[model samples]
Target chain A: MNLDFSFFTLNIISNFIIKGLLFSIKLTLVTLVCGLIIGTMIAMMRLSKFKILNYPALGYVVLIRSLPFVMVILWVFILIPLVIGKSIGSENSAYITYIVFESAFYSEIMRSGIQSVKKEQMQAGYAVGLTYFQSMRYIILPQAFRNMLPVILTQTIVLFQDTSLVYAIGAYDLLKGFEIVSKNFNRPVEAYLIAAVVYFIICFSLSYGVKLTQRKVQIAK
Target chain B: MHYTFNWSFFFKSIGGKETYLTWLVTAWEWTLTISFFGFLVAFILGAIVGIFRTTNNKYLVTFGNIWTEIFRNIPLLVQIFLWYHVIPHFIPIINKAPRIVLVVMAIGLFTSSRVSENFKSGIQSLSIAQKHAGLALGLNTLQLYWYALLPQAIRIIIPTLTSEAMNIIKNSSVAFAISIAELTMFAMQAQEETARGIEIYLVVSVLYFISAFAVNLISQFIEHKIKIPNQTFVKQ
Candidate 1:
């Protein structure tokens, strides 16, 4: 019943927890990059005029958005091995699943970002003798990215929180690191408490930075 | 080897017991219960904190800000684990409570931070003139809020609240980690028992999609019904 701070030894953290902290950061970076690239493509497809382009993209986003991220992670974890004829370890599965799952969310942000760019700007690009793709490349995407950067970062903060769920597949995320130390030291309560504090510090500071960026963006407009 | 899909397992009795479909339905009930009750806790706590956020009292504002930051920043899973594993150690009464109660509270506090932000914005969106007009008429701040401000603010933020509602439902799936018999748990258990991971997960996903879509439809209908005419939404 006692809440003890005595159990938190420097030796325990340095030995068992640092690997998980590194892995969590690595997984988050990979997911952000891969999710953004695929999400941008899906956003374009969803915005396209043709049904062939839009329907599948729309369906994918809707379907993924509706389900829980944990479910999707489990599905990929279980099903990927069956398809590939070998078990990809939990880390690889977590990476793939997060990227695929997060693309749905990132695409939504991109879609709104894309929509925020003025129609006149696209017209102006065309008037200046640029092709549609070239204009989008040079004009629209840049503006959209600038406008949506804060929102994108905010979502990435949420994504970072979700990286902890990789614990379901036995992936050594930050939370799992705490669990390991807790079991090893007979201090599940302290471990979880400290874990919460660590996650809170990271996410709070990141989102605070996002709020500042958002204000700057608003001022620029 | 090609995996053969068994579509009939959904209706057929599992090991000569109840149908697999029934098990899922039961699990779905837990999901709904957690989300609905969690939403209630979120809305009530969020409304109070949100009001504090909008107030001129510097101390209350700081307190509200700190509360929101602490809850909003931490992952829900970590919160759930803390509540489930650690809270009982500190609060002896919690040891007697059901795990589901703990799960609901964890999800509620986690969601309250998000809902409070929406509420804060809704309150802020009212034209300053509304506040001035209420003051000019000799109404106290409480009466001004009760009679004029809150109704309008709630109407303005209904759309955002609806999405938050859907979010709570999806997030409730994390309850399975602590062994709540939610949809995710049912799917995982069924998959393991049947070795039909693909089919089980696909069905679970569809069920989740249907439930979320239904909430969206119902909330949209409510928003349409309650909309204040000619009032534009506050731009993000």
Candidate 2:
């Protein structure tokens, strides 16, 4: 079982792996931006005084959190065509699903972040003649965001890892790129080996960066 | 919203062998079995690895760190692929191993890394005074950990560990990639066959939600039962 990675030359890397890497990055970024925005809203809703707002947000988060992420991906893929009477490709479906699915997780993170910001901050904003929204926007959220940046970044790494699951939906993600190259070169084992290495390098470095930021945040405190 | 629902498809048997509901029940059992074994492996091994990292021994600490980083960094899906396809090639004896065994190992190994991280932190989060006090009393390292360290650490870590425990159950769904016919796998298959895509996915999602929620409730109950009464000391 002699391994031959000669097949993964520059040509294959440039064409297949690079393409998949780009999609993975794109999906991660889009999901991060959208998920965080929506997650913040959900977090706020959960924190809200209104029972109508709180219970539904609570239910959504609980429901999404309980199921497997892969099932969410698959459900979105199946549901889109059924509901719309036509199909958006798996990549688009994945975008929608990830934004929806990851919001639950991000919202939980955000809620903790918000809670960490003391009630005094909100009261102080009100004392300064600020409205509810003004207090949230100008006072509460910025501090919460600063505290939660590392946690959110960590979740982004998890999302990056999860983008690989789009392979199940037949999306041309980073793992899919490796699969294609492996098929072309007939080196299944080496492809998988390299793929794992690539994922490890990217995630481990990002996590290391997050650790640095966390330390910096600690020192700032 | 107007699509007709054919809910009875779950009651109809394929080729008079077993109903779709029964088939799904079997699939659910497989999912539970895989998750149970996978979590068992992760919890035990992760605890050991976590302990190794905190120990004074230099080599064990490095080895434990390497183990955690390698498994934690790579996605569980890719790890599953490696266990399913790649590892068997080098080890001929296991090439013929069953799919379920390989899938369990993949999920277990991947989750153990996460579990190990939590354990490391739980142990580290304790005050140095505890260790010093134990040493002062002439407690050996083993007794120190068993009495002074682990009991407290376990309580502190239960909330986080509960999530990891729930995670392995969800992680077990990646076995679908290898067609292990677990809940996720069977859900997709049932959708393709029955053409009642929404209903099938809904039922499966509900099943997953119930199970995952059950784990959370159980952990909460355990946490309540073992609460340290009259806690006056501040945890650092």
Candidate 3:
């Protein structure tokens, strides 16, 4: 029951833990870019005047948001082989599932951001002879992005924490790195405790930055 | 590549005792039980900490902030693993308790941080006028919160609370990591047994959606019923 720090040697960390941390960071960055792009598209669709565009986008967000991320990862891992006729490996599946799943949440944030932009702004764009898409791209989106940046950053911090779920499918994430090193050193408890502290410190510091930015954003408006 | 869709697997009997659907139903029952009790714990704990955050005492506010940060920052799966694997070795009483108890405790505490944040915002959204009114009536702090502040704040927060409730249900799936045999675990095992991964996961996804949707409906109903007339005047 003794807490042991000696289990975490420099050799084990550099060999095992660093690889997982790199993969986790890679996955988070990739998902953030892809999810935000797809989410912005979905948010635009949901806000469309045409019913043909909105309903399906609305349904996708609702359906995905309702299910657990772990379930989605498991579903993708099992179903991908059948769809593509070969296993894509857990790492690729983790990437695809997170991008798809996180898009739903990001879209919600984007939707609120887009809605917060004044209707008058779009009208003014039209008054100056700009197309709807052009107005959104040039005028509305920049302001909306400014308003929602803090929230988006906060959600990304959440996404970083969620990278731990990749372990459920045997994807090599930071948590998996700890698990392997712990097994090697026979100090599973200490390894997990250290992992928890690492996650906490990273998320806490990032969220503090988010809070500061949120206040500045509010002041700007 | 044509994958066979076994439509009858759900109703088909297993081991002459129960159908696959029955097993899924039982597993779903466990999911609901864990989420429901877990949310109850979160609501109570979150309410207390959230109130502490708004209190006059700086020490209590710091303590509440620390509780929220510690629980909120750690991923739920790691916390669940800690509770299941590490805590039992230290606290023999927890070791003696059933596995469900530990799972519930972990999930509950994990969710409490979000609930507290929502509660704090709800309280902060109220204006200084309400506080002045309560003090003008010569009410004590506890009485003021009980009769005047909380009722209105809870109403303002119903929408946020609904989403939190849904989140708790979705999060309970992580309980499967510790082998609690919840809906996610049931689906995983059933997929292995039947080789019908698509159908099994599809059904589980729908069940989760229905539970979350039901909470949404109930919350919307409560929100409609309790809405303040001319809310803008009171919003500040």
Maximum-DockQ candidate: 1
Per-model TM-score, in order, reads 0.95, 0.96, 0.95
Q: Write the per-residue lDDT of candidate 2 for residues B143-180, one digit (tens) a residue.
A: 99898988888888999999998998888889999999
User: What order do you get sorting by DockQ, best first?
Assistant: 1, 2, 3
Provide per-model DockQ scores: 0.77, 0.76, 0.70
Candidate with the larger lDDT of 2 and 3: 2
Error in Å for residue B48 of model 3: 0.3
How much is A100 displaced in model 3, in angstroms? 0.6
Highest lDDT: which candidate? 2
> What does the lDDT read for residue A139 in candidate 1?
95
lDDT of 2 by residue, A82-111 (tens): 789899998899899999999999999999
lDDT of 1 by residue, A1-221 (tens): 66787878888788878889999999999999999989989998999999999999999998788888899899899888889899989999999999999999999999999999999999999999999889888999888888999989999999999999997788998899999889987888889989999999899889989999999999988
Clashing pairs in 1: none
Sliding window of 10 residues with minimal summed lDDT for model 2 chain A:
A74-83
Quote the positional error of residue A56 for candidate 1 in Å: 1.7
| DockQ score, prediction 1 | 0.77
lDDT at A65, model 1: 84
Predictions in order: lDDT: 0.90, 0.91, 0.90
